[model samples]
Target: MCQDVIFHEIYSAGLLGEISLGLKRDTVEGLLGEPQDISVSSTPYILNYGSLQLSFSSNDPHATLQSIHLYFDEIVEFPHGLQLEGWLPNKSVSAEEFLIHAEHFNVVLEEDEQHTFKNPQIGFKSKADVIVVFTIEEESVKLYSIHLGKRPR
Candidate 1:
C-alpha cells in the first residue's frame, strides 16, 4: 500500500505522477486523499500523509506546495532507483549505503558546511536548483529523512 504512493522526481525540479512542487494544496489532497494530519503552526504548513509530509507556502493565496519530506520507515523508491527501507521500527539508510546509491545515480552530494562529527547532514543542489537534504541520525549514522525543495533566496 505504501509503495503504491510513488514520488517520482521530475527533471530534478519537482515530483511527478503523484505530487509535484508548486501544486496547490487542494491538488495534493486530491491526488493523495486527505492528509492524516495538518500542522499549521509553522509558516509553511505541513500536510502529514503517513510517512510523507508535504509543505505548502503560507505566503501564497493558493498555498502552493513548497517542499516534500519523506521518512524512511517503509520501503520507498527515490531518484535513480534508490530503494530505501528500514529493518527495525526506526527505519534508516546507512550513510555509506546512501553514498553508494548516490554515486550510482551520479548524484553528487555536498556535505553541509555546518556539519560536525556529532551531527552530519548532507545536502546538494540539483540541476533544477532543487535542494536535497538528508537528515542523518548522529548515533547510528543512518539517514532518517529526505527533504526536497527549492533553494531559498
Candidate 2:
C-alpha cells in the first residue's frame, strides 16, 4: 500500500514517490527494500518489485536508475488526492477514469499515433526532460502500465 506517491515535473525531470532519475540502484533498494527479482539481460537492467519495476543503466548494484514502471494492481496515490486502485489481472481501469486522474496533475495524454492502430497507448511529455507513458489495451482501452522516465537526449 504505497500512498502519497508524488510525480514532480517542475524540474523537467520527474520524480515518482521517493525515486527519481539518476538515483543510485543501491539507494533505491534501500528505499524500497530488496527487489523480488533482478533482470540483467538488457542494457538497462530491471528490478522487479511486484507491481513496480525499476530500470537502471547497468547491471552494477550501484547503477543509476533510469526509469520506473508501475502496474495497476497496488494502490498508487498522487498529489491532489488522486489514486489508482486496480486489482491486478482481474480488475481493469477505464480510459475515462484514467484521463480524469491525469487531469488532476495537469497531464494531457495524447494518443501515440504511430502505435495507436496497433498497440494503442497514450503518452505526454511531463516536462522538457521527462516522458510519461500509459499503455492501454487495444479493444478495451484499459490501462495496462504506466511508465515514467527521462526523455532521451
In lDDT terms, which candidate is top? Answer: 2
Where model 1 places Cα greater than 4 Å from the true spot, the runs are: 1-11, 59-61, 74-90, 114-117, 120-139
Q: Tell me the tens digit of each residue's lDDT in model 1 across 1-153.
A: 333122224324356455667888877776677677888676878888666778888744479888887676656433422233322213566666765655555555555444324445555444554444455564565556656675668
lDDT minimum window of 10 residues, candidate 2: 81-90
User: What lDDT does each candidate get?
Assistant: 0.58, 0.60
Cα displacement (Å) at residue 80, model 1 = 22
Residue-level lDDT of model 2, residues 37-101, one tens digit each, is 88858687998887678899998878898887767643632322123332222126676675565
Model 1: what TM-score?
0.66
Per-candidate TM vs. native? Answer: 0.66, 0.68
